[model samples]
Target: MFESLGFEPDWFGLLGREVLRERRAALIAEACAWSVGLSDRPHHLRLRGRLVATGSTIGDRAATGQALSGEEDGRLELGDARPGSFQDALNAVDADGAVFADRFDREVIEPFVHETCVLAADRARRTRPGQWAELLDDLGEDGAELGDVVRAGEWEQPLRTDAEHLVLAALGTAPLLEVEAEGLPLSLVRAAEATARAAAAPRPEPEPEDLSGALFLALAAVREAGLPAPVPADDAPRLLAALAEQGLEPDEVAAVLPHLDLAPGTADRVAALLAAA
Candidate 1:
């Protein structure tokens, strides 16, 4: 008997036959309950004419029942009355009416409904470009105007991409004129007009250099002394040559020559010529 049952006779005598049978049944029941719970849908298992395990499926597949047996050593087996894999059970659960309704609303219903409304507006704009005022009249006396809607400041980003701006511009809506100006293609006449306006604008004159008090006094003294003004055309070369011999750079000469009261055009011409050298 012991050899056939795969246990030593001495062990059976120590545990007693009834105790061993009860323990084995308990182990089988525990294993069965765990294995049944692994099913994707609710499942039941029985062992030794008694209900042992029952549970609903979780995650993707039913938990592996054979592994749940632990050290039971193949003494137990699972029986499936539902006749399907764990995946099939999950599909049935998802197909339940309440679950399907909730999922459909979240995944498919809301987005397309919003898109359809926007597309309808776009279609209305395209088909009835000149009749926007007539359409607005249907809104009754208290309804919001197109100008009010454009100035609301809340729809700027959305209107940035919307095709409706072009329609509003075509309808001669004043509020959208700036948007129309920015978005409209630049014609050759408009481009030339912009360039001419820019060119005609008055330019600010350059700021005068700040002269030292001693430099001002020296200039005043020269004027008072009635010294003859040097002829820039005759004196510029000699002055530049003397400065160059003293190792003065062209930039240094340019800086110094500006302080001297030269003829109206001579200072600029001398600076430009020497700086190039």
Candidate 2:
């Protein structure tokens, strides 16, 4: 999946493992006496009275035997079901109801999104800075002489706006090609032109589904939850409303919501809206 999306497979796998670990931890912490165990089945949750088995599917005969023998004590068992994909696991937990869904997003999805963005930024940092000579060479006429003048810093006039564009392209920075046209060496024009061409050359954009949107969602939830969050408190309601418009119920929203030291049970209130949904 990561390869298909142009991500480093090893990085994706590392992130995936981290997400699974976090998900398990959060579920265990919140389970309240439920025994969580790992299972190989896709759907591992089996709730019998208070005994919740999250691992391998118990055969009917075994379940009956356990029930008859009084071994079906009240406990929650978590299983390690190998989900087909990260998204599949997320959806499974979501469908399990508000509590599991919320925990999954908070413990797994949000962190995964954060790490994905970090990776993307790291990759972007490795992009080679454009060269000035390379820009000059792209200019057909007077390219070489202009390259020399640019190197010597003895150019006269400011490059034309179009030439300036080239400089911006090559350096991935604003052009400083402006000079007194009369005193400017002709070479600067070609330099600027080359820079613009380099800048305009196609470069890969981050994938549309690179978890940025998920990160934004997590941050917005935090902002809405209150101050000490990375975003302003005033932006919370707007962000929450936007998220609501995306078909997330208050409970689902609250599951991934971050909170400040302020208002308590904010998540409960949000989750309460699940009924209205």
* Most accurate candidate by TM-score: 1
| Global fold similarity of model 1 (TM-score) | 0.19
Per-residue accuracy of model 1 over 1-277 as CA lDDT, tens digit each? 7689986443212222233233333322222222232233333333353433344333222233221221211121121212232212212223121222133234323332233333433444456555434444543422233333223323223332231222222321221123223333433344578799999999989886454543444455435544347526545555555556555556555666667667666566767668677
Best by lDDT: 1
Candidate 1's error at 237, in angstroms?
3.6
Residue 6 alpha-carbon offset, candidate 2, angstroms: 25
Kindly give the number of clashing pairs for every candidate: 5, 29
**Which residue pairs clash within candidate 1?**
33-53, 38-62, 38-63, 39-57, 40-57
| Model 1 residue 49 distance off true place after TM-score fit, in angstroms | 57
